[model samples]
Target: MDRFPEAFKRFEKVVAVEEIETFMQLRLAFGSWAGRKWVPTERQIEALNVEAARLRLEGAWRRETIVVRGKPHVRYRDVRTGRFIEKPF
Candidate 1:
């Protein structure tokens, strides 16, 4: 039995990349005004929560980077030849 799903599973709560980017900007903007005693508007708070949950789910599927010999390696693409190159230590 395949441990992975036979078909790609779509998230019911998928967030668009643009939305994520906008959420990040909003967070930064709010952070600058964090010292204010006034609470964020309900819509703003809801957006933040939604973004946070989406981020958590997205982060779970994120590819991890491993460092080797002080160099970060992911794919084996040659910078000069523009070809796939095997990793060489």
Candidate 2:
């Protein structure tokens, strides 16, 4: 991200990384939104609800949810060893 985007700047273009990420999180947690209001998709909402319940009920939800990197980077945990690893997004 630190590297200068010369061509991008010349074209007056900007990426909405934060907004897209926010939308994804919101949608995953609450189905989807529409018309300035929340519109629930039954399957998606139900799946999310079920996963939440399972995680909480199984005591496997205490681990931190890492803020993953973007593009060619991936950041996450090593499940079996409980170690944090950084590869890319």
Residues 1-80, candidate 2: write the lDDT tens digits: 12223422332234322333232353433322223334455433433333333333221111234443653533444333
Model 1 weakest lDDT span, ten residues long = 3-12
lDDT of each: 0.39, 0.34
TM values, all candidates? 0.24, 0.21
- Total backbone collisions, model 2: 4
lDDT of 1: 0.39
RMSD in Å for all candidates? 14.4, 15.8
lDDT of 1 by residue, 10-84 (tens): 222232334433434445444444436325664444444344445542211112255889998664333234455
Top candidate when judged by TM-score against the true structure: 1
